[model samples]
Target: MSIGVSANRLELLQIARAVAAEKSIDETIVIEAIEEAIQKAARSRYGAENDIRAKIDPKTGELSLTRNMTVVEEVENESQELTLADAQKIDKTAEIGTVFSDELPPIEFGRVASQTAKQVITQKVREAERQRQFDEYKDRVGEIVNGIVKRVEYGNVIIDLGRAEGIIRRADGIPRENLQNNERVRAYIYDVREEVRGPQIFLSRAHPDFMAALFAQEVPEVYEGIIEIPSVARDPGSRAKIAVISNDGSIDPVGACVGMRGSRVQAVVSELAGEKIDIIPWSDDPATFIVNALQPAEVAKVVLDEEDQRIEVVVPDEQLSLAIGRRGQNVRLASQLTGWSIDILTEEEESERRQKEFAERTQLFIAALDVDEVIAQLLATEGFTDVEEIAYVDLGEIAVIEGFDEDTAEEIQARARDYLERLAAEQDAKRIELGVEDAVLEVEGVDLAMAVKFGENDVKTVDDLAGLVTDDLRGWFETKNGERVREPGILEEFNLSAEDAEMMIMRARVAAGWISEEDLPQPEVDETEAELDAEDAFDVSNMDLAELEAEAEALGLDLDEAAEAEKEAE
Candidate 1:
């Protein structure tokens, strides 16, 4: 930091080159920063209002310093602007808008001036370096990067990544994994952000993709896109499960990821601080995938509820604890990997539950149809859950039941119909007694049972129903005390899907005059009209250059200027 810049031309160029090389920025950026610094110091040495400028030749290291003034009609501030009379004294050809330049001697940097110049240069260089880092790493997200751990402050690791720095926050680091200063580490670049402090490179060792990237490194097939890892679930630093599928029919995805004697997965495990890895072959069938995800345990049967995306898996009595894993970790990882809610039960438990359901259904049929226990048991065993099903089922379905003739089936159907009529009358009475209006029933999809349920929930009229949202009828999840809990909806027991609830609410809104049917979103468009509109659209591509130019001229548009700008853009 001496003031011999003009005398030492080689030193000035060397400093600029070194700073640019070290910061990984363009050499021109370093030169501009130096120019700004010199300009600042020169302004402070001369009057601050003087419009001083400085430039340096990159190759020859030649320096130029000048104070510039603009000629104005009237004298503004004398430092930077002068009247035409004063301008003509300096330059004979000066016009009103002409600029005049006067050469100035090199700045002799004082103590304060030198400090201020250093600050300006440092700030500009730092800004350029930050921008370079952001530009370099912005598109590098989702890739693994290697860096040396710089320091650990309050459990956050700062890494020196050669040209820049990155951080692995406490939450993003593997739990209980110790990272020491100067230690080499590999992390996934999950995010790169331009922040006030600089570019923040957020690295993560706990991200599931970290394991996937490690596999790509260790397995050549994965790296070459021959094998695909569709999903990964990790308990970071403890255990993980990855689902893999092979594009090549002959090669096994699991075997490729496992390598010879598990060397491939072991390498990833070592990097993750000895986390156990389960490599399972992925299947298009979710049940097969879930069964595979829960490694070291066998599932006896899996009943999938596709609508709700839930699967109930029944295991042998001995495999209950194993299937659930230690502290539910096995089932939890399986659920995450398959993207489904899984309910696990032992064989004995499932059998007991089935018997309980059968008994309840039998009792329901007996009470509703006023039939003998034998007939009711026959109906329940044949999968009849309600009187409604029996009343409308084919005559042959019940007549074919053991020891039942067509006459007995007819009698049963009559009883079922009579029972339903009586039930509907009682529910209507309950609905009216609960203050539910007849207008509510007029709304499409609203039956007596639903109206009664609405009245019980204080929704008595069509207007009241119209004011409700989908979540009010389909139930919603809430975060309560650190756990996700399901809050019961008004029609929770009705098993309404979100679309069904929304349709009912919209119908109510129309009946209640809250919204017209036409006001609702029309998701469907007539295909014939859509095709005609497409065919009728005017496309500029059909016009030749001359025709297009004539059209633009007709509209008073300058095609030549636009064509020049378009050429420049190209």
Candidate 2:
């Protein structure tokens, strides 16, 4: 106590110190208590209209108060209105708006105001303490704490977490998990806040971090340096995919976390209300890695394209349905686990895909046998819309089209052998070149003329021979005119027992950068149809511009004039 302060001031100082030490109250509470006490003392004697105010030196226990008043035209109530005479006693030049306060009675006044002052002081101290608690706890978010369920009230469960009471709203509680009063529960402190009732703490049993916390408790390998959890994705209370990696070569991270008979994972899953847990081994190679992400479903093949961060999974025909899981859960979890987009397909679909693809390649190379509008347009590209056009169309004429050059046109034409002799020689060389047995001769019901023609065209491999248009192949054999030989005929011609051709084309397209492996779409029969149609639409086939130019020149037509005519035709 200060020398000027009475015994009452010393007692108030002791009380302020006790409240300040309560952890919930800071020095603000002490100052507020003293100020309130002094204000109560000033108001008691001077009347409430006096506009009494107070300030207390909390460290020294010194109290001071002023009776606030206005200098009016004439004083009405002496308690709140100061006259020019009263104001001039404190200040000689008291103006119309000036105020003055006289020091009130000291020692006796202090003793008389003690009780009312104490009540006001205690009330202010409580308010400051509540604010302090609200401020202190609000910063401790995302922490795990143990609490006893006090009671469920108004759709919220009040938890006594020892240090403070927290409210677990109904939304944060897992369904069917009954929490009774006095029962101990572990929850994540999701949010600590200030409510009208003071500090409002929010606890959660349904947060994803709750499941993570459970694993941290049950899996020692995860807590230790042996296993590192890279990411956790969950559909809380349903299923979750956790990607984990082994820090040490000797440690099997997935196996360690799974435990014997899945005891370790089962424990965490039980804590999360039977939520399914998928423990996947993390991978550096996204393709091989995605294969591991969608677990419990056998993946036949994984095709990955890194540029798009996509992965395509080919599952066995029987496992396709499971690989995608109920509502696509398997693939969904796989996507979450690898952070990559994924597509799932079956073996049979992939097979039919290859068959359709082989037929298209065959059609692309059979330029001479087919002279339809679209084929004519493509053929016109090489200045060879038909067989007759090819005999005279020169290299420069071929280069005039979009992507063709003299060398490319020659290569295309050389590859497009329509005669039986050329077909046979090419097939013989292809057979020796690929080191595959020549089985086309043994194809039952196949004519000797057709077989000879196939050999002449160097169609040794199923894919190479499959490279001819059905109409052109028909033209070569002269068995049937303009009849299309599609997949069935090509399969028969090559004696192919399996449809491995689709996978091959996909691999080729991927290698060629036409389609990324990760973003492989479901194989479609019309994959090449649009490109073929676009080629057909361009009127470059068989119409050798050079020959047209020569004929026009004979008629005295200029090169520029011919080009203008061609553009107008287009």
Candidate 3:
């Protein structure tokens, strides 16, 4: 108990306790601190050139320092190493690589070494205690915690959570929220990590769960099983989308979350410093679910492309801005939450959009034409704006309008029939470009399934069908559009009819020079214009009827002959 003391045991123990207390440490930590302190003292007092060690019993008030010497064949450094014989004198079984120690006389530490030891021991003990503190707090991730504002540094707020300190990064702090040192505030444990200095705790006041938790605290239904929060997507400090389902049929999820006069959600809003939250109903149907996700804006219709996972929403023009949100944030969040690509448009926008679409279609129709704009415009005026429509029109109907005879109408229809052929040839050309298998297009008025079958049949071009006679064409047309012969209907189901079909064939015949101009529509001459031109050039007033008829007959002009005087000489 009374080994002649250098520094007072009471003073050393008191300093160790103080270091441990500063970090809320345990007894073993204090004992380790005591051992480190004594080790420092012995090193400075007796030369560090000599091997020495110190130990303090954790339960008992005991301290000891002894000189330890390694056993060797011969003494190399007389100050540190002892010969094997001498080592065995201390410990009979001492061998090479084994250390033997002997009790040493108590010694005093010098002023400088003593002071240095104090600082070194205090630093080591503080570092040990800090590790212990970090270890204790590391397991608290994902939990709400109460901490006091400690200090602010470089846009980071340091908080003193009761057991450890945490950092609230600038981004995690609520904007414009005041923090006073020592003021208590609650935050969620956003992260827990370790650094060289100590454990790192991250606190956040702007996390989405922060809002949910705030709601749970304020709203009874949300806190209970009556209202369940199914999913949440958020942009901290701006807006968030939360989907809720209700278990109790009587409770409305939105109404319950909103509470009386918006009190429940308003409380959460206040806690989040006015971060807007949209609560939407969760649905098993994705389309319905997306509709809910896009809220406060009414959606007119939702078209979901299941294969692409895309949702095209048609909304009223006034609601487009709302549905898209400011800078498209609303739809972006909705897309993220619903796991679908969203395209939102107003009703008017959709209409204008369709018009542009049809216009493009009409242009494509015109480009496929073998005729002039007059015919294209005429066909469009009759609502045949696409090549498919023209190809399927009957030649009889075509002969009724545009004043084309059967032969010319058939010729026109034949050219219009080339659309599908061209399309198939294009696909085949692309296949050739890709160095894939050679492909061909097949056209039939078959239903979708049968059309696909026909496409596989290699009936690629209208030119291919030109060899087919009228009877074969009739058979194909009937199989495709399900139209009966000569039916009275407002509009034909087939893009082309049998009469139009004949016109297409005849038109092909004309272009091949197989038919004459007389076989086509001739330009009708205006009698009035011809007569006027004749009167301007010739003095027909003095000509006799016989002379006029003879001259008209010779000139290839149809003359209007009146009672005329005889032309005597000539």
Candidate 4:
């Protein structure tokens, strides 16, 4: 079947089938392309004013050309529309809005017509190819694919992945790995997206999941799910760590991943250009997992700050360099694999830090509770860092402390309570002196210290506090160079939960009258303040009751009419 000028039969179906097979697209798409090209050429050969149509038989490749006219009540255009009186000559029952078709003779393929048809077919085929490429590769994302390096441009490698070309940008390739034309590479398909040109397949050899996929290929146990590779952290071609756990107790996950004489791991290593891998056993306990992640180093102890998701690993002085790796790579990869921030310390450093914490806590107890060094040290050793714990702990707990009798425990508790009260009173006075409004202080959960901090920042009114978000309040105490910085949110001294901070803001809103008390849990009023209000006199010498009510309305206050009745009785 020839596709050329001066041929009796173009064999369009055969040509479409051949092109579809070469381009890896559907045959119907190619047939439509041919029909569109023929239609365009027919419009050019015939008058451009005529409505030309073209169709090709799918099986025989026979071409048909015709002219179509719309039947209208009045013929608006002589070339495209015909009145029903003229349409009835072609068909007796022809009505308005009906299309009339008139068969035309086969188009003679002249030089200009053939050129136009060729260009149209080429354009249609290119568009169909782009659509096909987009559809084919869009769902292949996140899979490991093998491709041949086709070209390199400005540190980017273009890979030919059989049906489509993929790009591995310089940042997505392993560091220091060089590629040549036709070099076979295995990379993870990180993204497949359609753009103006076509679908772009983005490949990455530096992705951490790429290393895990390679292991899954090398280890049958990982592939079969007997041993699970839960997490992987990679430094590209330099090093990586994988945490693996075994569902079956008999099979060792690390041993199975290592294979016989390290053959399986060695295969993956070769593929990754000798990237060293540490296969660590996964554990539910974060401390144990972190200890395992920092392998080849003798860790003496691991202290986990669970709130911060940080781990402090203390090792022998000799193992400090090993635990930190070359330029801290080991600790960095371990932190990534375990999803924790790691701090490596020598045993001597850990001991020194412990002693410093002990001294700080003892000094805090001594200063806050006015206790002697002996009692402060005892409380600090018992893990009481502040006076709050001593003030609020159960009496029995203090009594059970070694060398403490019931009377002595009571004395210590009373002293702690007194100190806290005095400190709070001092802070309250300072907050008032700094011009903090009573409405701001009335908001529940914001202590005197926090109120003083707010006053220092000029957030002195309930409206100001209500306008703030949780983050604004959380950043109140952060400091830089002895001045508040507002970058770090709520340091350990604040002791504010996210919920508590948000609730404080809501309380401020209620106090500011921006929202009603019915919108949230009402704050408890002090009993002493309520009694004092009951005893106070309501003197109306300065203004009448109506004027008082107007002033209260302006201040968003509710005046009790019953209290007015009591004042009248008096």
Candidate 5:
């Protein structure tokens, strides 16, 4: 592969093939690099202003040099351009874009020229190698790769992944798990990014998916996709939980993952530096899945708050420590696995909470209805949570209560309505005292209670409410001291959904002149709503066939559904 003043240039193709094989790059790239080097050397040999080019015959391994000139109407440089008349003299069919090339004798590279060409070839080959590595590894993210631990630099583990290099940052490695140089290790390819130097591949041993990958390797059912791992939570070298479900009806997902006599799970545990693995069966019902997640501890009850995705789990008093685990690790992992905020309570604590809620409801009923303590207790026992429910409910519902006739129901409803009226009047006065403008109350969903809350929170005018975000009305959660804590909003007691809060804020914005009615965000048409046959819901009469097909596809409506709607329309 030498290129001295009188070296054999015929070995160009052989050199390209050898280099491409060594670097795992295409031979064509190597050949192009050599051609570029030859071009640079030829340019140096000829005058620098000449448009010199070099070409290599891929099959014959032959080299050729030529100087080219482009034919233009107006000649710019005497070296690189010529008038069309001159080009026409060389070739009769010459046009403006025609290029005329004159063959030049091969270059006899001087020592400096050889060195410069060598550097050019080396740089080109290196660039091609890097591009090859990037193309090969970019799509390998989320895959498990095996590599040798090449080195540990400043606490980061560098792995040689055969064709590419991957790094496991200090945080991505399992705790207390040390690796020696040249040791074989398996890791999860979490990310691959292109940098100035080369593609940077990020691998992780502590990622939850790493455990899932290990299980896939150990358990045939997982690899075959018969057993699906829905979620994974890892403490990294301490413990991990994986939720698995079986697509095959006869096979048990947990049993398959556990293997015969724990052999399968033990192999994965050995790989993870003895990390304990919990194989839980996944259920579509969140409560059932959460109960399965808290294994080895019996759950007395599970109450789910579907709107918030929070759960309250009541366990036996003796199983309290087991459910919580050391420093609350078990519950934390369970929350991560189930995507829910879990609050664990013992049966005794749950009983106390129930009694306290009952007492609070009873007290509210007595004061709102101006009833006796016995009547209040009866209303509370009948699940009457709010005075508004008693006021607005059908009289027959109240009369159906034990020992309660229609007359008693009427009296109770009248008192509840009176109490509500007085409360609204008081809230309105309080809002005025707090300097809230009457225009704020003009917005839809802004009742006297919400207006008073707005004033208490220093949002007195419509402009103030318009500037507030939905979180300021529906409340939000923040992480503090490594714990998620709820931050109360001004209208949190109203139990408004995020959509409802946003709508209220938008109405306020419209009323305050900050936004026009047309500027309010439009509701997206639901797929179901768009597929309805009712003309008021959706109209396909004006649409051409192609447009109707596109609309049907956009709504995700099947052909049968669209046909049925069309039939109904017809």
Candidate 6:
């Protein structure tokens, strides 16, 4: 007797096997789903109150329906439980908590029960299919997969990836690349996520790594680890740059990646829809790497600012356009590949900037130090960029300059100090006028000028400053104009380093009682301390005689004599 439709017990197993194979799921899971459907149908056929269960035999494809009743000392619900005496009639050894099964004939499902069973089986199969997809694709992320374009809805392509379906959002697709139904395409499996609806397999053609992976497949050296691709930047269907380094001393990474007569790179370019690929050698030095990244554009000079992770590249006036690319794409990609902000300048621009800086420094020295332009020009030519440098430099350094004596150096430093003091006083007056709170000024690097800027921006309190991140503070100081200018940031105007800004923010946090002393920045150890023997440096209080001797031996110092010398010096 069939429980649903016209199928028999053996046919149920046959259907489950076919579905499991088709869906790439386990046969046991399908069998359990069928059993649940059968149980639901059986309950509908009999009374709903009966404790019904359905089981299917694996080997023989046999189906069984039974009603389970528990044996207890006293039965309040007769349908579910039976007293010991009543159960003993069915089984002489029946005891408390023992379950008794009553076998029932196979069910003859009506049309409504058959429909309900179909729905149950369909729901279970869908859930199983979702689980199968999630399990199969979860580990396949970052792989390149080929699929047929199943359909497109609102510019989103749904790809049929053989065993699963993948989605490529419009933004993830290469620009100007149109996909038609049944068209075979390749994409990177960038993301695989499980959602309430189902497993989502996101594919991308514009990801930077997608191009890198394609090259890795096309180039044998890259695939075999002889050449490593450290970074990649792409503009999708336009241009792409990849930085490659060679492990073997003799192997040329760029030549190997380019293949015989550009075959390897052409393969990648074809895959990327005619996008231009520039294969450049990677360098440990960022300046050299950036120069290499801006190839075919002659670089006159490269000035690196390690503290800011920025590079100023000066190219010939004719090569400026080539260095910047169409709408700055070349420099932008170069910046991304080298992990630095790049500023492109022409030779003429650099020369003009130098002259302007020289004039400015000369004027500054003349005003601050009360010196003639000739003297100011001498100081500027010696690379005294600001008053603080002259004030803090070794006296010999300044006196060595032409026409400057030791007495002249002393007077210059004293004047620089006086000028700084007066500047600080003026800034303090302005800060007070702007109503900046004293607590903000208490932060180590939040001087009078910074405090005034903060007041202008409504960051008047210590808590306000503490709430800011380094980037927020940096952005706060950025000029409102779109034109890029040197020294545009307030931090730069005040000669404050990023570290200084971070320390100031941390100080504000500490002053607001938002953090403990343990969160404070550790004091940097002096170079002399770092040069000491490890035993003496790390554990001075617990040093043994043997360790002390070893330390003195390393330093070529006589322990007793050194102690006597130190005592006499003290």
* lDDT per residue (tens digit) for residues 73-110 in model 4: 97778999999998899899999999978888876666
How far does residue 537 in candidate 1 sit from its true spot (Å)?
A: 37
lDDT of 3 by residue, 322-414 (tens): 999998889988986777778888888888977786666556656786676666556665666567666787778676666567887787688
> Residue 460: error of model 6 in Å?
4.8
Task: Point out the worst 10-residue segment of candidate 4 by lDDT.
Answer: 483-492
lDDT of 5 at 347: 97
For candidate 4, the TM-score is 0.80
TM-score of candidate 5 on Cα atoms, chains taken together:
0.85
TM-score attained by model 3: 0.62
Task: Quote model 6's TM-score.
Answer: 0.85
Q: Between 2 and 6, whose lDDT is larger?
A: 6
**Each candidate's clash count:** 0, 23, 22, 0, 0, 0
Q: Model 3, poorest ten-residue lDDT window? A: 561-570
C-alpha TM-scores of all predictions: 0.85, 0.52, 0.62, 0.80, 0.85, 0.85
lDDT of 6 by residue, 492-565 (tens): 45645667778888989999999977898998888875555433533334568887677667767778755653
- Per-residue lDDT tens digits for candidate 2, residues 1-570, read 212235466566676787787645776667777776767666776677677877666767766666678888788987678777777787888988986666655544454466666688777876776676667677777677888999999778999877568888988987777889899888888887676767788888877677666777788877775787877777667788888898899989888888999999998887777888888788887776788877788988777756336667788998987888888777877776777778888888877866565445445436444434453455644334244345345656655566567776675445444443465577666655555335444433333444554555665444454344443332222224532223233333433322243443344345445567785446567958866755543232345877876756765668666566556546
Q: Which runs in model 5 stand beyond 4 Å of their true positions?
A: 1-6, 89-93, 365-375, 395-411, 460-469, 502-570
Note the Cα lDDT for every prediction shown. Answer: 0.89, 0.67, 0.69, 0.85, 0.90, 0.86
lDDT of 5 at 188: 97
RMSD (Å) per prediction:
14.7, 21.1, 26.6, 11.9, 9.5, 5.6
The local distance difference test score of model 4 is 0.85
Q: Against the correct fold, how does model 2 do in TM-score? A: 0.52
Model 5 lowest lDDT segment of ten: 1-10
Candidate 6 lDDT (Cα, whole model)? 0.86
